[model samples]
Target chain A: MPDPTSSPTLTVDSAAPNPAPNPAPNEASNETLGRFNFLAVIGRIILAFFQQVGRLSMFTASAVSHCVRPPFFPRQLLGQMVEIGYYSLPVVGLTTIFSGMVLALQSYTGFARFSAEGAVATVVVISITRELGPVLAGLMVAGRVGAAMAAEVGTMRVTEQIDALTTLSTNPMKYLVVPRLVAACLMLPCLVLVGDVIGVYGGYLIGVNKLDFNAASYIQNTWDYLETLDVVSGLVKAAVFGFLIALMGCYMGYNSRGGAQGVGVSVRNAVVSASILILISNYMITELFFAQ
Target chain B: MSASPPKIALSGVKKRFGRKVVLDGIDLEVAPRESVVIIGGSGTGKSVTLKCVLGLLKPDAGSIKVDGEEVVGLGDRARERINTKFGMLFQSAALFDSLTVWENVAFGLIQGHKMARRKAREKAIEKLAQVGLGADVADLSPSELSGGMQKRVGLARAIADDPEIIFFDEPTTGLDPIMADVINDLIVKCVKEVGATALSITHDIASARKIGDRIAMLYHGKLIWVGPAATVLDSGNPYVDQFVHGRADGPIQMELRG
Candidate 1:
């Protein structure tokens, strides 16, 4: 359980030359400076959160707006779809398959004493759809897409390409974030659905070959026990997880403060935060759905 | 518009990060097409001052007006409107490594203006030519070029949009003396050709005199002196004298944390 909130601890040399950025100019009164600092820190924290949310909101809005605009970058969108969605398939697929296999194995040992071995199919399908498919997919995408997004945008930010975009009268949020977010929002459900199928198939293999269950019976039992709500809930969770992963990636990259060190921190923070937020949000969504 | 305004103006602009005050109170103005170079040592609020006017950093106090519109606390739409009129050449010649030379140069034209790729590529090539690069180099990535060439690409990118205001932040910091002079010449020529208002911050006195119509010295978060570039040698300010001479011993002390 890697806590996302844990700050990276590095033993930097005290003598390392800090960018002793000069103090602000004199117009701020002593009173104003005090208030400004207090507010700025609080504002920065709020702003950091807002910048991500705002960027996400603005990105989504602009993307939707662009859907109706004349000069749509369909080529760029297609390229991003490949980069962000299609290319990410193998990693998500493999992780889901393995998770399903392991979950089936673990659940069987626990459920064996109760002689409820038939419940393995139901447990696997329900758990995979409700939690594992979305959560594991979220974490996998965090490691894959989240880090990649952070590094790509983080580099652009530090290198001033983002500023260059600004100078050219382009909204970076619309240009950079929108395509990625759109791709993630649209594709994660597809990925999770694929993941759900693969995961269930994996559970079936383990149940039949390893645990000596009948193959026909396992597949039939998986479908029999799975409600439409279960699959729909996973798809819904996938969409939220997708938004969070892309949001955190864009957020950390957009606000990358320091130079090289800042970019590294951004990548790490993006992946860690997205993964944590996914699980936390998953639990909340689950609680909400089942509470009644 | 009711009478054309000054190109850019900042009056008593102040910004601070925690206990660290980056810009005390910067009051400066750039008339249309004028070139102003700010000279200061490292860690002096030179870059922060530029950032404030660029609307990248909001000031704690004071007014920043570009073409007579107060920009200090403007919203994103307003800020983007102001930003579109400006271009910046960063200290490191921060060209996008992932993009080809032409694509990097044409990024603004394409992404910002939504220009067609063909027209933007043509425009990018034209800009590259202005900076002494050939069409052959346009398709190559920025990383393939040397430091000087990369700086040229940066200069090309800066002017590609033909912005009304251009900022050069330590444009010659890492270049050799000859290369630095070449960059200075390119900057002067390009700024003149574009007839854009130029505001540059640098410690290089030679570069300052070469590229500036006027030179201002920032020390202790204040503009200690601002005058015509020709008169910088005789500014009669000790801090300016110490800085311009690059003396080992001066009022500016190296901070040794206790």
Candidate 2:
């Protein structure tokens, strides 16, 4: 006798012919199909958006929480800052400085055609402070620091060093994400500040030395055309872009899959995502500040 | 000898990823200062089992006790405290490329435990030597080392903290056979020297036999057979025999992609 509590067993009948319920099984599949028909599309999009937003906010929060905690690896932070902020100086400075000089020459040429050569200072300062400094800094950082962060952490993730960190009682977020995020947040603004000065200085150098403009008059005019909001707003944008760049770096790196292929993909994604996010955020902030 | 509780124990641990079941249910135990090697083929959830114990992957339902303390659902702080007693050598030699070999070895000691740099440096150098690497290699970046040397450095780092529980995941993979044997020997010597409970997972049967006092074979997310290393060949289980012989014509089928 079969016990009442016994589990059901599948019995195979060698001699019996089983009938195929084609229509019934097909109808079951049809019901399964209907369940996913309209809901799938809308649910997928919503899930995707929420997932993106969740990841972004989670990255931001993980970074912020680690910023104020102990087990502070000052050496790692300072090294990252130097690597990210200071080492980036030459590239950002050169890009903006040349841009400033080019802007001056271009402005002179354009304004000269219109018989408005005196407007060069206004153009240079407004363009450099309002647009070039933050954007150029963001792009350079996306290329340099963002790619490095992705590659380094992606390799770690693939190789399971991140796992090792957790096993060792060290939080990978605290150790990896925090220092980078904090360094970027703290350093990017400073780098942008430096980039602003250098870019404006480049404009001055070209305006006076190459463009035959009077130095005192150029400086005075450049200063006169500047509003506090322009500088403050650019700095604000730098801060936001800084956070985005680092967040993208950490996110892509942390979530990297596959192996060597995955690390390469992560690096590419980090740069692309960070650059796009920076531009989008820059526009949003600009609109917020000057949306008259 | 009077018993202190087992160093590590898992009671019917199970883990699943979506529809794919990684570990169905696992029951394991590692006594203090004992070396247990888990042998399994790829995709047999060997790594998953190790990760469940490491707390990297949370099991769906079951208890994992380390030092007789329940760790399955511990909070972050408690988890961190528990993790301090564990060290792991990953499948790949996952040394920090940015840091020198010595610094990589000293990472947990300095970063996690707040050991002073000088002392940590000294300990790191000593650990490196214990792994048969010279002091000169200590100052060089991990990127500069060969795969075998990196594995040694990884091993050094794993034991640098002298953790009570050490997990080695595919420790001998990606190395020359001789170098693999060398690593296996070093792992045995190191684990023995520290008296640390060693739990390892590998597909390498040779490595399993070499390092394990007791060996368990995982098949279909379950431990099919466990016995002393000397008796593994004669375990009398068809699955274990099929696996140990590396045969394709057994219960495990080879999927031919046409």
Candidate 3:
């Protein structure tokens, strides 16, 4: 089976211009290819990339501005909160739990060779809280919430419901986009916090039962080494990831054109963009918080 | 005193998507409480014209005036103010599936006008009744309704605010002939009862005759012929004749692409 996580990116990239543009027939006929045409194609690709970045940045700025503006929709925001946060908890929790368990087992085996098996609990707790919990939760939510937001909004766009909202004297940005952004930003941190606890507990389960470590000592070691900054940084990363996820989904959906195929492309784009941004920003945020 | 300005007017309007020009310079006017229908083949920019007037799509050039106020390039706040005076019934009814029939109808009142929910519900039921829908239909989701019923609910929502102007986009495009006539009749009744100026776009000649006071034919991005609805058959414009009589052979040729 195709990996569900990377499938969206594959579809979106297929829709985009071929990464290696096919050689033109006339150019292929010429043994010595003209350098200018190749440069022109490269230049066009670079320009298109920058153009898309500019558009997305503007959309993000507008959505963020609307999040702080008046005429807020508390009910809509709450509805999105439930959708993004409550509905995503199980998947995030399961992923983090397995990840923590596996990390503990791998670290225990490595540390056993060095006669340092006691470090397994500390390693699991630190990794889960500092990096894995937020990153995993972010990716999972991007798959679930981001894809759903894009599909729903994209369908609304194609069906003229967004235009209908405009004609009804409601700003589509404020009515649709802002609530999702606010909900994601506020809720992702909460999800990361919960996932962090569940993940540490998962490590504890493996350390105590599967690995012949004392339960109390494992718990004590986890608490002794995991610092407050670790959790705080992870939550911070979660917030940024949440914002980008919601922004990409809304931007792709709002600009969706054509019809059903357009909506499918948008759904794929939302998941792909959100996943890449989550990974990139995770590193940047970690550097910001921990780099010397 | 200067004569009151047309309820809505467009002059020298132009819109092009990429290289294809959908609307070339176009001019038209709808006097107060006048029902004007623009007839055109699919893809001839009838919807684009409505979108431009509704500020959903911005024209590339020229002026669009609503109640004598130039709306082109207006900011969101100004556009919102302009939209409050208008309502639209989309071709698909475009009801919010997330909201019930009553909530959809009361959306503008509650969200835009900030009316109390209880009062808005009462008014929504009243409007639904006006469209011949019973109170029981108010709480059901729009998805549960049949196409004709959805169109009725759409009409009810469009007139809920008693807007000064209402737009009906392809009001009968997908309906059976009988249902289309019913919708057309409701449109006429609602527009007349609300005393709202009406602007509609459709290819249905029977609907055009029933709902429009004046009919204009759009061909090749321009209003090729415009006159009273009764005189459409006698307009003497070949394009109008070809379209009205549904002739396969005409001066207007379809752009067939392989």
Number of the predicted model whose TM-score against the real structure is largest: 3
Residue A263 error, candidate 2, Å: 1.6
Which candidate, 2 or 3, has the higher DockQ? Answer: 3
**For candidate 1, what is the lDDT?**
0.86
Ten residues in sequence with the least summed lDDT for candidate 1 chain A: A7-16
For model 1, state the Cα shift of residue B166 in Å: 1.4
User: lDDT for every model?
Assistant: 0.86, 0.88, 0.93
Place model 1 in a CAPRI quality band.
Answer: acceptable
DockQ scores of all models, one per candidate: 0.44, 0.61, 0.85
Name the best candidate (by lDDT): 3
**Per-candidate TM-score, chain A:** 0.78, 0.82, 0.88
Mark the regions of model 1 whose C-alpha exceeds 4 Å error after superposition.
A1-79, A106-116, A210-213, B1-5, B254-258
Off by over 4 Å in 2: A1-46, A109-114, B1-3, B254-258
Decide which is better by lDDT, 1 or 3.
Answer: 3
Tell me the tens digit of each residue's lDDT in model 3 across A14-102.
Answer: 87766457657646656455656698789999999999999998998888888788889999999999999999999999999999999
Ranking of all predicted structures according to DockQ, beginning with the best and ending with the worst? 3, 2, 1
**Candidate 2's residue-wise lDDT over A1-292, tens digit each?**
6654552442333323344435688788879989897898899999999998898787778678778877677787888888888899998999889989999999999999989998998899898888889999999989998999999999899978888788878888888988888889888889988999999999999999998899999999998989999898888888888888888998899999999999999999999999999999889999999999
The TM-score of candidate 2 is 0.89
Model 1 C-alpha lDDT per residue in residues A123-155, reported as the tens digit of each score: 999999988998888899889999999998998
Query: Ignoring the other chain, what TM-score does chain B have in each prediction?
Result: 0.96, 0.96, 0.98
